[model samples]
Target chain A: MHFHKYEKIWLIFGSGSLIVFLMVLGFAAFWKGTHPQSHIETIDPQNIEAHEAFQAENLGLHEVEDGKYIVNIVASAFNYDLGKDENGDIVKTIRVPKGSSVLFQITTRDVVHGFQVAGTNVNMMVEPGHISRFETVLKNNGEFTIVCNEYCGIGHHLMFGTVEVY
Target chain B: MSTKQLTFSKQESTLYMVFMHVTFVSLLIGGLMGLLQTLVRSGKYTLPFNIDYYTILTVHGVILGLVLTTFFIIGFQFSLLGKTVGISKKQLRAAWLSFWVMLVGTVMAAITILIGEASVLFTFYAPLQAHPAFYFGLAFVIIGSWIAAITNFRQLYVWKKANKGQKSPLLAFMVTINMAMWVIASLGVATAVLIQFIPWSLGYAETINVLLTRTLFWYFGHPLVYFWLLPAYMAWYAIIPKIIGGKLFSDSLARLAFILLLMFSIPVGFHHQLTEPGIDPTWKFIQVVLTFMVIIPSLMTAFSIFATFEITGRRKGYRGVFGWFRKLPWKDVRFLAPFIGMLAFIPGGAGGIINASHQMNSLIHNTIWVTGHFHLTAATTVILTFFGIAYWLIPHLTGRTLTAKLNRLGILQTIIWTVGMTIMSTSMHIQGLLGGPRRSNFSEYAGGEQVATWINYQLAQAIGGSILFIGIILMVYIFIQLAFFAPRGHEEYPIAEEESDALPTPKVLENWYLWVGLTIALILFAYTIPVIDIIKHSPPGSVPFSWPIGRS
Candidate 1:
C-alpha cells in the first residue's frame, strides 16, 4: 500500500511514541518489578476465615521489621475489616510511622470491591477467592482515606477506612 | 448534476426512522437519569419517591451507553448498506426481525431496571446478580444484534456476488467489519450470560466463579467500547470527507486502519483487569502490549483525516501550511459536530492509553478519572459524531431538509454540549485524582479530609450535568423538527469518493478469512493460558447476593 510522504512521517512519529511507551512499561514491569495488585492466590470467599492470614486475630497491621509492616484486610459490602484497636473497637484507622514500607494484602468475602488509598498510588481490585496486594512506602506524613472505588452494592459509598502515617 | 441521488427506498427509510425514534427517546430518558445522578452526587439533592441512586445510575449507563448507541449504529449501518449495496427484501425482513427482537429485549431490560430489580450497573459483575428477566433481556439484545450482523454480512455478500470483481463501498465494508467484530467479541459475554449468569441468577446454580464471569465480561467489554466507536470512525473516515467537500485521503489507509482495529481490539481485555488478582502480570503485560498496537490504526486515522482536510482546503485555493484547516465548513452542523468529536478524541485517546497502561492503571483504576476518560471518548467523541450524523441522516431518511434555523440551533447545541462536557469531565478527572470513586452516590466519607476536597468538584459536575440536560432537550427538539416539521425536500446521504489519483485498495484487505483468522488467533494467544489458569486454580464460588439492589 502507498502512503503519502507526510502520512508516513506521522505514522513513524506515532508508532515511535507508542513504542517508547511500551518500553517504559516493560522497564517498569521487568526491571523495576512493578505490577498491578495481582496476587494470583485464591481463598474461599465463603470460608475466608479458614485462610490463615484472613483469620480475625491475624487480620490487620503487623510489624514485620523495623520501618516495615503488612496489613491484611477483609472487604465485604460497605465494610473494610481492619482488625481492632486496643480498646476492641473496630479499627477504622491504621497508623504507621513515616518512611515505612507497607504491604497491603486484601480480599473480599462477597462481591468485587476496590481498595484504593485516595490521593496515593495504592489501589487494588479486591475480589472474592483471590488476594489483591499492593506495597508502597509511606514517604509522606498525613492521613489518607481508603475508599472503595468499585461499585459493590447499595452502600458502596459507605465503604471506607483510613491510613495515617506519622 | 446529471448523476442520480443516492437514497434509501421508502421501506428502508421507514425502518431506519423507527430506529432513530428509539435512539432519541433513549437520549431523553438516559440524559434525565444522568442529570439526576450528578445532582445526587453533588450532595445537594436527594432522590425523592424512595428512588435509589444506583437504579438511576444503571439506567443512565444502560439506556444511553447500550440502547441509544446500539439503535443508532445499527440503524445508521442499515442505511449505509441500503444506499451503497442494495438490501434484499429477505435481508430487510431479517433486519426488521432483528429490530423487533432487540426492542423487546430493551423493554424487558428497561422495565427490570426501572423497577430496581437489576442495579448491577452496565457491567453487571457476577455475585451481585440481577433478576433472571434482566439477564434474559440482555441475552435477547445480544441475539438480536447477531441477527443484524448476519443481515449486514448478507447484504454485502449479495452485492459482491453480483458485482463479480469490484471493491465494495467503503462504508459498507466498515459496517461489516464492525458487525463482524461485534459478533465475535460478544460471544464471550453471551457465553457468560447463558452458562453462568442466567442459571445462577435463576437459582439453578448455588455460586458463581466471580473471576471467570468478570473475565468474560471484559473480554466483550473492551471491544464493546470499540463497537460504539467504529461507527463514529465510519463517519469520520468516510462520511466526513464528503461533508467537508473533500475526497477520501487514502482508501487503502482507511481500510488498513479498520483491519488493524479488528485484529487488536479484542485480545486486550486483560488491560481492564490489570489491577485484579488471579491473572499473571506477564499475560496482563502481553494484552497491554496488544492494546497499544490498537493505537496505531487510530494514529493512522488521525493522519488520514488531517490529510483529507489539508488537501481539500489547498484545492479550494487556500494557500499556506495550515490554511486548509481554516477552509473547513464551520457553519455546517454535519461537519462541525463530528469535527468537535475529532477534537475530543485527542484527550480521550490519550486518557485511554493511560487507563490501559499495565501498571499505571492503578493511578486511575475505578476512579472517577476512568469515568471522566470515557465521558470524553464514548460520550463526547462518539456521541457527538452520532449527533452530527443525526443532523443529516434523520432528515435524509425522513425526506425532510435541515433548514438554516435548525442548523444554527444545532451549532448552539454543539457548543452547549462541548462546554458542559469539558466542565463535567474535567471535574471528574480532578476529583478522581483526588481519589474520588466512580459509580458511587453522595457521601462525605465520614468527614475525611480528602472527601472534603471532592465536594466542590461534585458541585461543578452537577452544574455541568444540568447544562448537558438542557443541551439534550435542545437536541430532542431539533430531532423533532428535522424528522417531521422541516420542509419536505431531498437531503443528500453524503458518501465521500476516492481522489482521482488514489491508489487502488489492496484486495488482500477484503479477505475475511485471513482477517478473522488473525483476530481469533490473537485472542486465543492472549487469553487462552490466563483464562485456563483462572479456572484451574479457581477460588470457591460465592452464592448470589441481591439484598441491596437486585431482585431477591
Candidate 2:
C-alpha cells in the first residue's frame, strides 16, 4: 500500500477532537460535582372537608404561598364540579388565604381529569398516589381558572374547575 | 468480477442523485429556518424581518421530519434494495413519483403555515385548528409515502418469493422495519384526519375531543421518529463496516436490533403524552416501562456497531480496546460522519432513556429539555448519517471522485456541527430541568431574575447555534460541488465489493429468533393495551381516588 499524504490531516483532526472531548468531559464533571438537585415536595387531596369554600364561580383564579393544602377534587367523564355554591350550584372553588402557601392536591373518581389553575402560574402533574405539587408564592390577590390540560375522554373540552383566592 | 456488469444504469444513478439533492436542499432550508427562529427568539437579531416564528417552526418540523428523512431513506433504500432484491428502473420511477408527491406536499404545507394558516406543530396538536389546506396537503404527503412503502414492499416480496427460505439482507431488514413502522404508525394520524379532524374542520362533526386527537396524533408522532432513525441505523450497519475496513460484528445482532425497533417504537407513544390529561397514571407507567424496553435494542446496536469499529481499528494497526480510536480516519467525511454519528448515540440514548423514565419525564416534558433530547438524536444520529451517506454515494452516483478539498470541508462541517449541537442541546437540557418550556416564542419572568439559569443557557444555545449555522452552509457548498464538477467514475470500485460472502453464519441470524422475539413482544403489548383502555374508558362515577400526600 502506498503512503497517503492526507494521513497527517486525519491525525490533526483526531487530536483536535480529543481536546474538545476532554474540555466537555471536564465541564460535565464540574457541573455534576457542584449542583444540588431540587427535592420533591408533597401535598394531599382529602383534607379540605367542610371548610368555608370561597367559590370563584368561573375557572376562577387563586394565589397561595409556598406550602401544602389538600384539595377535594371529584372527576366525572363529562364535567368536573366542586361540591356546591352559596346558591347551591355545584361550584369548584378552593380558596386559600392570601400570603399562605399551598399545593392543591387533586384527583379523579372515574376517567382521568385535568386540574390546571390558569393565570396563577401553578400547573402540576395530578395523579393517584402522587400529589402533584405546585410550589409558588401568593404575591398577589386574584382568581384563576383550573382548566384541564389533559383530555379525559370525549367530554374533555368541558372539563373545568374553579379556584377563588380570598 | 466484470467491470462492465458491475455498474448501475444511468437512470438508477440519476434517481439516487435526485434523492440526495432533495435531502440536502431540505436540510439547508430547514436548518436556515431553525437558525432564524433561534436568533430572533434569543434577541440576537432585531432586524425587521417579518418571518413568523410559528411558520418557521412548522417549516422546520415538516421539512426535517418529513422531507429529509424520507428522501434519505428512499434514496439509500433504492441502492441497498438493488443489492438485496435486484432493483429495476421501473421501480425507480415509482420511487421518483414518491419524491415529487412529497415535494408538492412540503410546498403546500409551507405555504399554508407561512401565511398564518396552520401554526400547529407537524403533529397538528388538535382542537387547535389549522387551515384545511394544511391537512389536505399533509394527506397528499402521507398517501405518497404510503405508495412508496407499497412499492418497496412489493419489490421485497418479489425478492422473497424468488429466493425462497433465504433470510432478508441486513439492508433489507432495516428498510423493512422502517416501512413496517411507517405503515402501521401512519394509521393513527390518517385516522385522526379522516374520522375526527377532517369532519370537524369540514363542519360535519359538531364537537371533537382534543384529548382523543392528541392520543392518536402522538401515536403516529413517536414512531415517525423511529422511521427516520432506522434508515440511519441501516447506513451504520451496512456501509460503516466497509468504510472502516472491517466485517460486520454480528449479522444476527443487527437483525435483532431491527426487530426490536419495529416492536418497541410503536406502543411507547404515551410517553409523549405523559403530562397530557386523559391517560391514567398506571397506564403512563406501563408506557414508560415499554419505552425503556426500546433502550435494550438501542444499546445492543451501539455495542455491536462500536465493536465492529474497534475490530476495524485494531486491524488497521491500533492496539488495546480503546487504541482502535487512534487509527480511525478522522478527516474522511465518508469515515468520520458515521463514526461521530454513532458516538452521538451516547447523548441520544441517554436522553431517550431519561425521557422514558416516568418520574424523570415529568421534569423534562414540554421543556426545552425535550427539544434538546430530540436534536441530539435527530440532528446528530440521523442527519449526520445522511451527511456520511452523501460522501459514500457521490463516487457511485456522479461517477467522479469527490475533491479532497470538499472532503476536508465535509469533515470540518461534521465536526463543527457535532460539537456545536452538543453544546447547544446540552445547555437546553439544563435549562429544561429549570422549567424552561419548549416552543415558547418569548418567555419572560414577572420580575428581576426567577429563571436566570435557564436564560443563561438559552444565551449559550444562541452562540452554539450560530456556529452550527456556519457548518450547515459549508455542507451545502460541498454537496453542490459534489453534484456539479466531481469527475465521473474517477475512482473505480472493485466489482468484488458488491457481492456478499458465504461465511460462517452467526447463530442469531441462522435461526428464526426475530419471529420468536416479535411474538413475545406482541404478548407484552397485549398486556399494556387493555390497561390503556381500562383507564381511558372508566365511567365518571366508577371509583373514588385521591392524590397521595407523599411517597416512601
Candidate 3:
C-alpha cells in the first residue's frame, strides 16, 4: 500500500504520458484549424422543385452526355436514407438508363463519406477538400442503393443514396 | 495402483496448449490459402480464379487476422495476467468455454467462406450480403470473445475487490484496459448484427439501414486493432526487460499508456471513414485530428520503452543513444521481439502519422499504401511480439526449457518477418502512390504498358506474401517444438538475477494517476458523444427523404 512514495516513478510515467498526449492534441488542433470546415451546406436531393422537375428526366441518369445538369450530393459520416418506401420500408428505387456511362463527381462538404453504387460495382470516398470521381457503364437497368461503405459516425449506415439504372 | 491427478496449474497449461494448437493449425491453413492465391494469381498454374479468389481471400483474412489474433490474446491473457490477477477456477473455466466457442465459430466461418458462400471482405459491408451462417458464425466468435473480455475484467474486478487500495498489478491493469476496450467496441458491431444485419439477412428485419451497420462495425473494427496491439505492448513493457538482463523502467508509464489507449482509441474510429461521403466532413476532420491525437500515447510508449532500454543498458555498462543497442541480446527471441517490433515501429509510426494527416491521408487512403502501413505495424510488429512472448513465457508456464538452437532459429524467423514486411510494405506503398487500389481481387493494365506497373507490383506482392507465410510457419514450428519437445524440468530452468528482475509492488498502492486517467476517459467520451449526437439530429439537408430527426 506504499504507492505514495513511488510518486517519483508515477511522475516519470505521468509527466511523460502527459507531454505526449498534449503534443498529439496540439497536432490535431493545428490540423483541424488549417482544414476547411466540413458541414452539410446544401442538400439538392431534398429540393422539392428539383425533385419534381427532374423526376422524369433524372430517373437514374446521374449525368447527361455533354449536357450540364447540376446535382448536389452532400457527404456525411452518419447514415442518410436515400431509399425508403412510403410505408417506411427500404423499397424506394432509382432508375438509370442502360448502355450509358455516367460521370458521378461526388464531393463531401463535411467529414468523410462513402459513395457506393451498390450491386453495380461503384464505391468511392468523398472528402471535404476533394472530389471523388466515379464513371461507370450502366450494364443492367435496376434500382441500386448507393450505400456508404465507410464508417462515419454513429449514423454512418443510414447515410444511403439512391441510383436507378433504367 | 496410485492415480496422480494434474493440478490446476497443469490444467491451465493444457488449456493454453489447446489454443496454441488452434493457432498453428490456423496458420497452416492461412499459409496454404496464401500460397494457392499466389499460384493462381501469377498464372503459374492454370485454374479458374473465379470463386477461388474470394474463397481463399476470406480464409486468409479469417485465419490470420481474426482467428490467430484471438488465440494469441487468449493465450497471452491466461499466461500473463491470469497468474497476476489470480483468476478463479470458475472464471478460468468460463475462459475455456470462450475459447471453444471462438474456435468452433472460426471453423464454421472459414468453411462457409471457403465454399464461396461468404465472399464479403472480412469487413462485411452491408447490401453486398453473404450466407446467414457466415454472419452467425462471426457473431458467435465475437460473442465468445466478448465473454473472454468480460471474464478478464471480472477477474480484475474481483482482484481489486480482494485487494482494495493496492494498485492493480501492471499486467492486470493493461489487460483490464484491453478488456474494457473490447467490450465497448464489440457492442457497436453486436448491435448492428443483432438488431439490423442478422435479422435483415435472415428476412426478419425488412429494409435494414446500411449506414447504421457501417457506423457500428467501424466503431467496433478500429478499436479491435488496439485490442490486438496492446497485448504486444504489455509483453514489451512487462517482459522485455526480464529477457534483456534488466528491470522494467517504469510500471506507471506502462499503466498510463494503457489508460490513454482505452480513452483515445475508441472515439477516433471515424478517421477510417474519411474517404466516404456520408459523414459530415467537420466530424471527419475532428476524428482525423483525434486520430493524430491518439499518437501521443504511442510516442510516450516509444520514449518510455526506449528509456527503459537506456536505463537497463547503463546498468549493464553500455553508453550512448544507440550504444544501448550493443548490450541487447540480438539472438534471443525474447530480446529480438521488442527490438524488431520497435525497429518496425519507426516506419509503422511514420505511416500512422501520415495516414492520420487529413490532406496526406487523401493521397494513399484505401490504396496499397494503407495496406503496407498496417502490415508493418500489425503483422510485423505485433506478431513478432507474440512470438517473443510465446518463446519466453510458454516454457515457464509448461515447466520447461526450450532448445536454445530452435530459439536461435526463432530469432531468424523474426528476421524473415521483418524483411518480408519491409519488402511488401515498401512495394505496396510505391504501388499505391502510383494509383494502385487496395482490397482488389485483380489488377489490370491501363494501357499496353500497364499505367502504374501494377501487375509487376502485384506479382512482387504475392512473392513477398509467400515469404511472410513461410516466416509464419517457422514461428508455428518453433512454438510447437517448445510446447511438445522442450524439456519440462522446472528445476533446470535458469532463474533471473535480482538486478534483472521487475521491482515488486511499492508499499502504498493507491495512486491518483488511476483516478486521473478515469477522469480523462470520462471527459473525452463525454465531449465526443454529444458532438456526434448534435450532428446526428440536425437536418440532413436534401438527402432524399425528409431526414428523420432523432430516430434513435
Candidate 4:
C-alpha cells in the first residue's frame, strides 16, 4: 500500500521508458511500415505444389506488377526452395536486378522455418501453411545468402538460398 | 525477532542437499554441452557417437534451463517453507514425492536425448516431434512441479487458516505466488504436449496444426523464463539484503512485485511469437504492452535493491557519488555474484523490450541476439544468483561452514562467469546482428566467404565457453569443499528486516484467487482468438519421419 520515495520515482521513470519505447515501436510498425509478417498470407501446407504461385514456372520469380518481383519459396526440411528439396532439387539462386522491389513470399512445406536474408531486414518465420511475405528493395549489386534461422530438423544448418543482385 | 539464526530440520536439510546435488550434476553436464556446442560451431571438433549439434543444443537447454533450475528452486523453497511454516512430516512426504517424481522425469527425458530420439529442443514445437517418452517425461516433470506447488499451497492454506488474515511470511508468500504462476502458465505447454505431441509421437494423430502447436508453445515459453527468475527474486528480496548488512527497502513493494508478476506474466507470451505467422499484429501489439508492464516489477526490484544498498551504506558512513558502492562487501561472493547478475539484467531486460516490439523484433528474431539476450537474463541473472545462494546453502545443508578458501574460489568463479558471459553474450549479439543464426551447426557453413566473416566471433564464443567451463569446474570445487570438507558450524537463514516504517504489508497481498482469476482471464483473452484462427486456417501437419534428418 505504501512505498519508498526513491522506489516511486524509479517506477514512474521506468514506466515512462516503457511507454516511450512502445510509442517508438508503434510508430515504426504502423507509421513507418516496419512491421513483421503481421498481416499474414496463407497456403495449404499439405499441397504446396497445387498453390498457384508455386507452379513449376512461377516458383522462382513472378511479376506481381511492372518492375516488382515476388520470389515465391517453399522453405522445407532444409533448404529454401521454389517448391521442395529432392534429388536434383536446386536451391534457388535468385538473381534480381538492382533497385528491384523484391517481395519474398515464403512458407514451409513441412516444419517451422525462418527465412532471413543475411545483412538485410527480411526475416520471418516460415511455417507450414502460413505464408510470411516481406518486401524490400535490393539497392546495391551484391550477393545475399538467405538462411533458415529456425531449427527445422537436423539439416537446418545446411539450409540456405542465395540472392545474387546485379 | 532480530535473532541471527534460523535452522532447518534433518529431513528439510536432506531434501535441500539432495536437490542441490541434482542441480550440481545437471549444471556440470549442461555447462559442458554449452561449451562444446560453441566449439563445434567454431568448427574445431565434432560430437562423438553420431551425436550432432541439435542434440547437444537440446540437452544444453533442457538440463541447464529446466532440470537444474526446477530442482534447485524446489529444494530452496522446501527449506524456506520448513523454516518459516514448519512443514509437518506429512507435508515432507508430499515434498519428497515431488522430488522423486521430478528426478525420474528428468532421467527419462535425459535418456531420450542421449539415445537421439528426442533431439527436439526445449521448445519442441510439434511436427518436428520427439519420442513419446520424451513428451511423457517432460509432462512428469511439469506434473511433479505441480505436485510440489500443491505442497506450497497446502502449507499456505494451513498457515493462513490458522493465522486468520495475518500477512503470510514474506518468503512463503513470494514462493507460493511463484509456484502459482508456474502452475497457471504451464497449462499452455501442458496442453500442447498432452493433446498434441504425445499423441502425434505415438502415431495417434495423423498430423498436427503446426501454427496451433507453436502458439501453444510460446504461450508457456515466456512464463517459463519467469519460473527460472522469480526464485532468484525471492533470494534477492529476502536474502541478499541481509548479506549486504541492509534491510529490505520495502516489504510491501516486494509483495507487490510478486503479485504483479502473477497478474502479468502469462498474458504476454504472444510477444515471443511476434515474428511467426498466423498471429495478428494487433494481438502482438497488445501483448507487447503487457510485456512492457512486466518490466515495471523488475524495475521495482532494481530500485528496491539499490535503495537497500544505499541506505545500508549511508548508515555505515559511506557517502558521495559512488562511495556507497565501494563500501559494500565486494569480496563476499554471497553478495557479489548475484549483484553482478542483477546488473546484467538491465541490458538484458532492455533487449527483451526490443524483441517484444512488433517492428524491432524483425531485426534480431531468430538470430543469436535472442540467444544472447537469454543468456544475460536467465543464464547469468538466475544462474549466478543460484551460485550465490549455493555459497551458503551447500554448507548449511551439509552441516559445514564455508571456509575462507571456498569463498575465495567462489569469488574467482563468479568473476570468471561474468567475464565469460560478457565475451560470449556480447559477441553473440554482434554476430547475430551480422546475420549469424543460432541453434544450427555452423560448421555446415565452414569457410564459405560469407560464413568466414563470422569466424572471429565464433572464436570468441569458444574462448568464452572455455572460460565458462573453467568457472563451472571451480564452482563444483567450491561446492565439494563447502559440502564435504569445510568445518562444522551453525548457518543462519538470511532474512532482512522490512524497513521499520513500512506498515504491515497489505493482507490483500496474501489473496490468491483474485490474482489467479485475473491471470486466467488475461491468458484466455490474449490467446484464444489467435489460437482458434490458427487452427481454423492451418494446414494439416506434415509427416517429418520419412525424411532423413541431416546431410541425406
- Taken over the whole model, the C-alpha lDDT of each candidate is 0.91, 0.63, 0.63, 0.82
Query: For residues B1-552, could you state the per-residue lDDT of candidate 2 as single tens digits?
Result: 111223567887787778788888888998887887677657556425655565677778888888788877877777766655656667877888987887787778778877766756566654456667788788778887887888788778887788677666667666766787788788888888888777776667755554556667777888888888888787777667767677766665677677777778877777776554335555565666566666667766666676677867877788876898777767778878877778877878777766765544555655677788888888888888878877757666787777787788888888899888988988888876655656645434322233445567878888778888998899888888777877665543211122244243354543435653673475356335644553355322112211110001
Best TM-score goes to which candidate? 1
- Root-mean-square deviation of candidate 1: 1.4
Q: Where does candidate 4 stray beyond 4 Å?
A: A39-41, A64-66, A83-91, A139-141, B1-6, B444-449, B544-552
Report DockQ per prediction, comma-separated. 0.82, 0.06, 0.09, 0.62
Instruction: List where candidate 1 sits over 4 angstroms from the true fold.
Output: B1-6, B550-552
Against the true structure, whose DockQ is highest? 1
TM-score of each: 0.99, 0.76, 0.75, 0.96
Off by over 4 Å in 3: A1-123, A126-166, B1-8, B38-50, B448-452, B491-552
Local error of candidate 1 at residue B263 (angstroms): 0.5
- Per-residue lDDT tens digits for candidate 3, residues B252-309, read 5566667677777777766665445445555665666566556767766776677667
**Which regions in candidate 2 have their CA more than 4 angstroms from the true location?**
A1-101, A105-166, B1-6, B46-49, B490-552
In candidate 2 chain B, where is summed lDDT lowest over 10 consecutive residues? B543-552
Tens-digit lDDT track of model 4 for B121-188: 88886567677889899999999999899998898788778867567778888889889888887888
Backbone clashes, each candidate: 0, 15, 49, 0
Candidate 1 or 3, higher lDDT?
Answer: 1
> lDDT of model 2 at residue B240?
77
* CAPRI tier of model 1: high
Candidate 3 lDDT tens digits, A76-162: 445332323446564334454676666555554344456655444455665433445444566876555455544333344345555
